[model samples]
Target: MLWRGRRQSDNVEDERSDTGGSGGFGGGSPGQFRIPIGGRTGGGSSIFIVILVVLAGWYFGFDPSQILGGGDSGGQITDDSGSEGGGAGAPASDEMKQFVSTVLAETEDTWKGIFQANGLTYEDPKLVLFSSQIRSACGFASAAAGPFYCPGDHKVYLDMTFFQQLDQQFGASGEFARAYVIAHEVGHHVQNLTGILPKFNNMRQGMSEADANHMSMQVELQADCFAGVWAHYTAQKGILEQGDIESALNAAKQIGDDTLQKKMQGYVVPESFNHGTSQQRQTWLARGYKSGKLSDCDTFNNPI
Candidate 1:
């Protein structure tokens, strides 16, 4: 993909180099088995998280407020062990950061146009680039959790190290592959805007874990399709190169929930798939890419 000279988003907040001492949640154990790593602030911060989740739920039409307040607030950031050095990474990480910001800006442009065409206002979302750990409306998350979109904060959280992992470990080495991951998360933000997220949350209540997982798969597949739609527009704009689609497909294949499960546990559990199969992901993405239409990505209506 040719992304140089493109507009970069100002909504990004970089917190990679900042470091602090280790602190644990001060609140008494919430009966959780795992030890708390991020520091817990007063109950007010927890309440703030709750409020954010409630707002997001109202915006998305789902009651996701329950997912908030599950942890402490204003937690201390862990040491920046995996963060890029200022002097060393200043040259390389800056470039990566710029690239990500540019991609995010482009996503905003594409989504804005789509929303306008559909007679809706587009709300721009923020993307945070962090290293090691960060606090979000979804509570504290480590880099190990990968890139996630927290509806509560309307922000996408990413660790650039994941791109390296995508290349070296997952065998998805292309820059477009990395862009695909960001687009997928941004696609979730799109669902939030379109009221699909709240509906899914409502349907998930009291459902069996398997049934919920199936619904989750549909949601993920739809996001992949949205990414394809973005790809379609980019291709039309001549921003996408010949092998960019292949890289994206390779990424979709590499991160399929079934494939990841099989690789990690030496087995696959279809019932627990939250992100669809490799073939399903690749097919849905390709469908959107080929059709260049949002109507083509109705995974909830079509059988997998």
Candidate 2:
């Protein structure tokens, strides 16, 4: 990966300190509600917690309103923050934090160039580093639900522990694999900027559960392709070592919905697959890596 010693992003928010003051989880203006950290309340804390729970539920295939005891919680949820352990918090090491910041800066550089070439301005997104649980513009989330980008806030929420899980649980070790995860989430931010996410969400509104899942698969696959696009640029800069691409491909395969479902339930259900199969993920990522063109990432129109 060769990420160390590179420029680190100033857009990173280190909420791991847990010293209070909104935690800067999503980098947005203060909202009405905020999460109660350690029984603390006020200053818009309760709403953040509600939003985090809802967002986490959405990632884990559940309705936030249902999980939060119906839709009566009048406030709009936003942003994220959290600690480590089963809920106990811990700060991320300086090396890991620096590594993430470096990766994020590279992605910013890559995307900014690509967007400029396409006659579009690139907006840098803030990356939030949290522990066990965090709040986001889309809602709250835990490390268990994996990394995600909140379109509402245009920020990427990451729980560093997910890197450990990626290695120990998914067997997708290596710096490139970790980079792929960050890139994939940043890809979602790109989608938000390009209006793909809003359009997809609108389309999914009237869809059946199976149909919505299919739409989500396209969205996720496109993000994977975007990640590969970033990788293509990095490779051209001669920063990628041998086997770097393979590590990313292995990661894509390991996180496929089919593979995860089989690992969890001993079976695969195609209808419920929102993130595509292992082969599809690897193939789309490869397509972007080979072509290095945004036009090549039209997962919705093209067959996977």
Candidate 3:
């Protein structure tokens, strides 16, 4: 969590100023990114559509290229314009922006080393920082949808306000917890690079709603494990503090599908769960942290 004074990623994009219009697929202008928000129902295809649409871009692994056009496979970061922001229009105090960039840089370093060791090249992903809403290749997303990775654009979209929500609404606090959130989204980027996401999507084609949710859970749990893998490297480099792991674990527990559902509805529905239960999330994350190997994060082959 000792992030300040560390290296900040050049791939960080400040799109907070680009609010007020939407322009990608759903129509509007550049900054006016708005999407329909509806109440969550307990049954029928409406709920299924909502879940699919939300999960399509919700946590990870929906190829926006299939829906949005031209599939670009490269990992290079392109600016909203052609040139990079020399830190222009980043966070005002530079506190949150600096923290995010540092963590992203560290993840880049860690993943690059890991990929090289495995005889593969690591492609660094750009992190887009937006305000209330943003238009991604996947579609339009609001801050309420939380942070997500779009495989189509090869970018991680994050709304920093989610950090406040994590602390106030979800009861997950601390810098490491915030770092875990970034790492988890980056983990999805990793999965995309590994071709795991496409395979999962293909497999989900003929699956029932519940079955698809289970597959999605596996994908998300694997990302959590990848986050732990990043944490393992940070710990090895002596960057992680004493309570850092605990902070991340608490975060994993706090955002579990089971926990969130209970908080929202005062009950739990197992079949509708897509991100795994609290125990499953914590277990996968802990497994990666303890093992520090990509093979250990094979949530698809192993049961949760």
Candidate 4:
């Protein structure tokens, strides 16, 4: 993608070198509790219970990331009634920072135009470049949690190292693939603004485990489609290079529930699929790319 020399957003804040604050990992409101991914637990849990929670999460598709948060430590799932999280770390090079800002600026432009056409205003989400860990409105998060968008504060938190992993660990590379990651998270921001995220999240509370997994799949697929919509507009601007679309599609395939599961566990569990299969992800992404219209991204109502 021809992102350099393009408009760069001023909304990015880099906090990589600021890790020593808030007692290193356990600050925030008194009542705020975190669900650490696999960190130490204050209320120690046996590995058996940890395995159970992981199995439960896999079986019911209950959660993807609300597991290990921080300071108030545990390997179990925690309620979402907490404040932000994160710590200080190293920085990505200046060029990477520019790349991130440029991509974010493009998303701002694309979404703003779409929202205006739909008679709604667009709010630009703040993008934070942190190293290793960071605090977000949704609670504490580490780089292991990957890139995420927090609806509570309308900000996207990124650990740039994930880009390296996307290439080396997941075997997906190319700048546009990196851009797709950012856009996918930003898509969640769009869902939040559109009330789709809140509605679905609330609806999941009373839903059966399988039903909630289905709902979550819709939510995630729509975000992938939204990323494609962003790509659609981005391509029209003459910035997309040959094979750029394939790069993004490859990234989608690499990170699909089935692909990741097979890679990690050496087998597939169909019922635990909350993010759709590789073909489904690529299909939805391509569907949105075929038409830039937001109306084309009805993953919830249509068969995703």
Candidate 5:
């Protein structure tokens, strides 16, 4: 969490001010749609209105995958698809952007070292910061979808506002908690590179919903362990301060499938758990943090 005064990556593409461009909300919709733009009204309300329009478009029938150069849309969708949010002369709405970049850079350094020891190459993944919604290689994603990693592009998409909700709504504050969230997504990228993802996808093809969920729980727990591994390295690098691990552990517990489900839906469904329980998440994360070994994170063979 001691991230300031460090190198900020040039890999970040600042589409935060580019509005009037292709790949706006309707670009991915079927039937060559158009976004209803308001005239030169310089007010905060305009941005909110635009966000609402985008949401409405999505709610009706907009599918980001269709027009985002995926299955159709006449090959308009390219690797550089979609735009980041905000307007001209506008700053990032929160400190999360800088924090995100720092965390990403830390992950890059940590993983690069780990991979070198294992005789493999580590490719850094792009982290996309958006406001309400985003168009990613995995298709259109709303902020409500939370942060996710898309193997299609090997990038992580996050709505920074989610951090606020995570603190106020989910009761997870502390910067390391936020870092843990980022690390979890990066963990998915690690799985993708290690061929674990393909195997899971293949197995899930014929699996029942319950069985698939069980496998998903294993995947998520492994990711948590990976996050702990990142923490271990950062701690060794003297990048972590006191109570950082505790904050992250609190976050791991806060966002567990069991805790979230019990809070949101007023019930718990064990068979529907994709992420493991709060205790399982905290324990596995602790295991990785303690051991700092990839071998220690074999969630598939070990009990949660």
Candidate 6:
């Protein structure tokens, strides 16, 4: 990805200098994450995580709004998130800052076009850059939870160190892979604007755990698809280099619930999967990349 010299978004809130103090995130142990399950408790892990692992079930797609303000840890499903450096991420260098800002700007441009074409307005969501931990309207979160979009505050939060983790820990590298991560969270902002997220959030309260997980899968997969749509238009700008799409696809595959579960434990519990499987994620992303059409990303309507 030839991202240098690109326009950087002014909407970014660089709070790295503030360094929000440490506190227990979601009341879970630091450097690890817990998946909240309703009316279910086992040996303190997901059936998919008994061997001990989880991505917050949302590395790139974790929406803190769902977990925020939900009381009690009796159903906490804990796992090692490879986040053991303990919330103290070094500040994002100027170069990294520029890259992220550029990616955000690109996403802003792409979504604006799509929304305008459909006779709607597009709102550019703010992206917050933080170190270690930060307080959000969705609640307090650590970088270990990975980058997430908070509909409560209409902001995307990040710890730039996650890009290094994505490459070294998850075996997903390349600039476009990082871009896809940013785009996916921004996609959540799009869903929030178009009422998809609001609908899911309202309905999930009444849904069974399994049914809610299924719905969450649709929401997350659509975000992945939206990321691909961003990539589709990005390619037209003549900045994409060879192997860019493959890197993004690999990033999607790496964070899929099934793939991460297998990589951590050895098997998968399809019922506990909130994000789509590796194949499903890749398929949706590829579909959107191929068509560049929001119509192709109806995970709720199509068999995914």
The best candidate by TM-score is 3
lDDT of 1 by residue, 1-304 (tens): 8987655666687878754123563322111111111111111000112213432422322211122111221110111223222433332346898788778867876776666544467797888888877777656666766787877678888888999988887788888998888898899898877766666665566576766666677778888998997777767666778899999999899787677777677787666667777899899999888866666776765787
TM-scores of the candidates are 0.77, 0.76, 0.79, 0.77, 0.75, 0.78
Q: All candidates' lDDT scores?
A: 0.66, 0.66, 0.69, 0.67, 0.64, 0.69
- Provide the lowest-lDDT 10-residue window in model 6: 37-46
Give per-residue lDDT, candidate 5, residue 101: 68
- Runs in model 2 lying further than 4 Å from the true structure: 19-93
Model 6 — TM-score against the truth? 0.78
Which candidate would rank higher by TM-score, 1 or 5? Answer: 1
Question: Order the candidates by lDDT, highest first — what do you get?
Answer: 3, 6, 4, 1, 2, 5
TM-score of 2: 0.76
lDDT of 6 at 112: 65
lDDT of 1 at 287: 88
What range of 10 consecutive residues in model 2 has the weakest lDDT sum? 38-47
User: What local lDDT score does residue 304 receive in model 1, on the 0 to 100 scale?
Assistant: 77
The sequence of per-residue lDDT tens digits that candidate 5 reaches over residues 206-295 is 677776667777777888998897787777656788989999998888877778777887777776666778899999999888867666
Per-residue alpha-carbon lDDT of model 2 for 63-145, expressed as tens digits? 21222221212111110122111233222447888788778877877776555544567898998887767777766555555
> What lDDT does model 2 reach?
0.66
Worst 10 residues of 3 by lDDT: 35-44
lDDT, candidate 5, at 65 = 21
Considering only N, C-alpha and C atoms within 3 Å, which residue pairs clash in candidate 6?
87-132
**How many angstroms is residue 32 displaced in model 4 relative to the true structure, after the best TM-score fit?**
15
Please, what are the lDDT tens digits per residue for candidate 3 over residues 1-304? Answer: 7766555677888999888366556632121111101112111011123223323322243221222121121112222333322356333456888889878978887776566544567798999999988878767877777787887778888888988988898888999999999999899888788776655655566677777777777778888998997787777666777899999999999888788878887888787877777899899999888866666776655777
lDDT of 6 by residue, 1-304 (tens): 9877555666789999776766644632211111111122111111222111211222223322232112222111211222211123322447888788878877876676555544567888999999988887777877777888888888998898998888998889999999998998898898788766666665666667777677777778888998887787777667789999999999888888877777767877877787777798899999888866666776765776
